[model samples]
Target chain A: MNNHVILDVQNLKKYFQVGKNLTLKAVDDVSFQLHEGETLGLVGESGCGKTTCGRTCLGLYSRTDGKVLYKGQDVHLMKGAEKFAFKKEAQMIFQDPYASLNPRMTVSDIVAEGIDIHKLAANKKERDEKIFHYLNLVGLNKEHANRFVHEFSGGQRQRIGIARALAVEPKFMVLDEPISALDVSIQAQIVNLLIKLQKEMGLTYLFVAHDLSMVKHISDRVAVMYLGSMVEITTSEELYENPLHPYTKALLSAIPIPDPDVELQREQTRIKLEGDVPSPINPAPGCRFKGRCKYAKAICSEQTPQLKDMGNGHCVACHLYNQ
Target chain B: MSKLLEVKNLRVSYHTYAGEVQSVRGVTFDVEEGEAIAIVGESGCGKSVTAKSIMGLIKTPPGEIKAGSEILYRGENILNYDKKQMSHYRGGESAIIFQDALAALNPTMTVGKQIVENLMMHRKTIMVDGKEVKLTKRLAMQEAVKMLKMVGIPNAEQRAKQYPHEYSGGMRQRAMIAIAFACQPKLLIADEPTTALDVTIQAQIMDLIKDLQKQLNTSVILITHDLGVVANVAKRIVVMYSGNIVERGNARDIFYHPKHPYTCALLEAVPRLDLKNKQELASIEGTPPDLLAPPKGCPFSTRCKYCMEICCEQAPAATDFGDGHEAACWLHHPLAPKDDVPFKTEVRHE
Candidate 1:
């Protein structure tokens, strides 16, 4: 990976107001950086703020606080032409392929929507050519150009979503659970296609997914999230091999290996986390994961810990790691 | 262990706008008492149809279980059973838990009442104070709460009194499991039980299922696409592709010494959590064939890398590898080249 920082998020926070005096802190005090051609995976369970954080970084959701900088320019502060340029430079692939693509629009029209917006093509023939080019790049044939989005299967629809994002020629992409909806046999195909495309296009990616194995497979670095807080961030290998935080350890251990022999061996050493994730709305003052954390202490509910670097660029936010 | 359930030559088809969709085509398997078996495959592979057929949940007019299909439950052919016998067979002898607990459960009834009604229908007596007594409404309510607590749900009393929507995803699933096991049925078919749950929760549920199977000594047929989950809970696995049994073996046999191309490709396809280094995933080349006018040969032949000329024309019969392990593939034929089978020489067997 290059030393150039493509995207930098600083102390980002996004909140939603539900009741008269209640505030839902969806993405609270989360920060990370994406290097050129590097894929940073944001992983957490469902209802965690990983999706919200990705959206805030892409300027899809306006941040309630902090700044999201793209190439040294603030994404949320961009104006008319600058905003348009940022949109062209950054694209998002949604989680659900079935719901994301418009049913009425043909595959060619869905893909060319971005190309036409950026005025990448001059004539109708050029537009058609650009459309088919992206479709082919994602493993679809030109014959699929005229077909409706509903006609294709889940994997094909995801490919179309990828093609739509790539048609914009974006330097940065935020893939939000792009392969979660696809089947087991089909997820690898999409993951491989994404890796191949990143290599060919030199694109930086912010891959947000709940599937930890795939996240580790596709990411250079990974950030683990709790309710609304980032519990750990480190190189993918280090995070998987030597997780520090209690929540991170539990999360990693919870993923069942495909091998029966390994699963048999791991059963004894697995960390069984107690209770469910607590409510994120008006969450307690202490650590967000203290309710489910096995190693939580008295001070854990009083003061929230910030991310601290241990070594080798590994950061853990917990009282146990604090000392 | 005796055979608790046996499905022989199971054939199911659905009527669509175009033609009949041959869903479960000649699937055959048996589950021994107290044993947990898994039916694994991708979408449109008829794993769910097989599960539904076992539960007698298939609609007859649009969907039909063809003649000669037999789902024998303890020497009794359930296919010939009328409505009264079918209802008696369901829940009393066998029960199924669905993927979406929210949808499967009744919206109007309290969780406790649903369990109570299920218990009242299937069972008449409860073990109280080490004595068998007629089940009263109050006793059934307490039994329902007991079942809820057994499935690891906390505050069982209050949670049981609440509606289905009031409970969380994991809790609702726990409640569903409670109801399924309330009757202490001999057979339990969990259709993708944890597919909608998160990873950590999925592991928890799988563990709970394993524990319950041991406690109740109930036979289980787990239907899911997740191979990792299959590894954890299933003793034996039956792999399906396009409504056909592609491979069947013990968990170790399928994972360590897979012979079928589809099975090998599937194992290579998943990005395992045990991965030490970055590696490109090996994927099957094409999508599964359409089942409307299903192919005559191996359905996986269209995408199999080792597909031979014979594979396209004829379906290969099951080749046994001893110890209840078998795979349907032409490459396993004695005349076929032996060296070309990549998964044939895995290190674990030696």
Candidate 2:
């Protein structure tokens, strides 16, 4: 419940051209705000443009429309020292730890890349000390500084990636599926480390992931995306307990709980979405989830539904609710 | 219930340059007829190796099944089967569906042709109008379309004519399921079948498999790392850790009253949606033991919180808690020292 806004995105859009004429609308008219010292989880299945939305918010990809404001300054329009300052203030932790870090570089060098680029340390000693400090902060020790990325396990390599992200001293971080590639036993370690670091450093995070259960665990608030559109946004507790959107209900029901008793008995209540996600390319001029929604009506296919606030900061984008 | 498959004292090792990696050591479990048994474990825990060994798909040179391993299918030991006998037993009696449908399916061949090929290899005749008719290639293709339709793929006839890449991830998985059930294999091995799919699509695929399994009475060996996935589908749960079975029990028993420290750690590790508060997840402290140089004692002894003095010296034997629920942990021993803190039974809320 942080009242201060760290980053504000409005009508953000990112489109990729496929061939001569085909355009894939990766992120379309998505808007959200990240509060300081809070984690906003963006949850959606594969190809729903959650990753694209995260990238566009950080100016990693040029937005085709809308604006991304970082501390009331247009992120896309920044230049020179301001842009560099923004880069240092905002960082990203990639999904694939294996590919994100340079295999040839030592772990120290990998962590120190952001430090050296930002010139945070004065000399070689200061740089090495800073690198070692970050490595230790992420549960790694001094012995792992000199080893190459390949020498480390998936969890360790992910630690190195986190060290690299935190080395820049970013107030805001974009964690794109940080734990998806990790093993089950190791995923909790990374999540706990992130939560601990966030509490200690007062860092704000935009955690984009498809794992809804884990997302709800770390995020203070959650946003649901469907086909490059924001379908729902609310507090993590409210979103899970009283989901208003049909897609959110279906998604929550689809997730198999580890408890066999509840899952077996609740089988009849589980909503199995009949078809796959609709194509984002040349999308229909209507609610993106209309194709799979059971309550879709005539108006659902004619006009795109806009996200409307339904009191207490809960928002949903569906014709049945909005109309 | 009759036993569909029985594995006993199975051990598997990989020939690495460093040494022989004991991927699976002394694993034993049995699958009853039409029962769904889930083999759950993390990476390098030898769950996949156990499934592969059961399917006879392990390559001999680099990967070897130890001499005493016994894989009995329908009262016959499949481990001793020759190549011809294994081939006949594999396609005709059992089949497997992989995680990555695109990678498992042939790219060049049509989906129909692939299913038809599998049918031709297994079936020679079909009942038509109460009379036995010789099954031909065309008839198999027709049956292939029907199989695709059975799995809920719309426009099955046209979709069958398309290549694997033409279908989406969920459709491809459905196609894979169709091919697996084409022969109506009495035993089906689904190795992380829904791991790569989305949750909604994952739900759909799981529902399809369960429906078909009931219709065909196919005993399934669902191998996966996610404990949540196996809850609804599998009647029995087998928890493995570092090439060993740490716990085996009914699904409800495993979820409600997990005895093994590793199982307790795992149950606590998974983040539940029904949790009211955003508390920290309890992760196991260390990584899995090295297969090449396995620990002298229990595999999970390094990370276990309830590890006792004797646990570091030798592996614990299985302790039965009645009704086929068993756990291999020193905490269950009668003479073991009681700790001040008690184990929590209900990790999740209703």
Give me the candidate number with maximum TM-score. 1
**lDDT by residue (tens digit), candidate 2, B1-350:** 99999999999999989899999999999999999999999988999899889889999889999999999999899988998899888878999999889999999999999999998988889766788899998889889999999999999989999999999999999999999899889999999999999999999989989998899999999999999999999999999999999999999888888878888788888999877867789998778888998988888989888777888899999988777888888777777755732353222233
| Second chain TM-score, each model | 0.97, 0.96
Off by over 4 Å in 1: B345-350
Clashing pairs in 2: none
Worst 10 residues of 2 chain A by lDDT: A264-273
lDDT of 1: 0.91
Error of 1 at A235 (Å): 0.4
Residue-wise lDDT of candidate 1 within A221-261, one digit each (tens)?
A: 99999988899999999998999988888888999888988
Query: For each prediction, how big is the interface RMSD?
Result: 0.9, 0.8
TM-score of 1: 0.98
Two-chain DockQ for each candidate model: 0.79, 0.84
Per-candidate alpha-carbon RMSD to the true structure: 1.5, 2.2
Tens digits of per-residue lDDT for model 1, B1-350 = 88989999999999988899999999999999999999999999999999999999999879999999999999889988899999989999899999999999999999999999999998889999999999999999999999999999898889888999998888889989999999999999999999899888888888899999999899999999989888978999999999999999999899988979988888888888787868899987678899998887889989988888999999999888888888988887877877767666322332
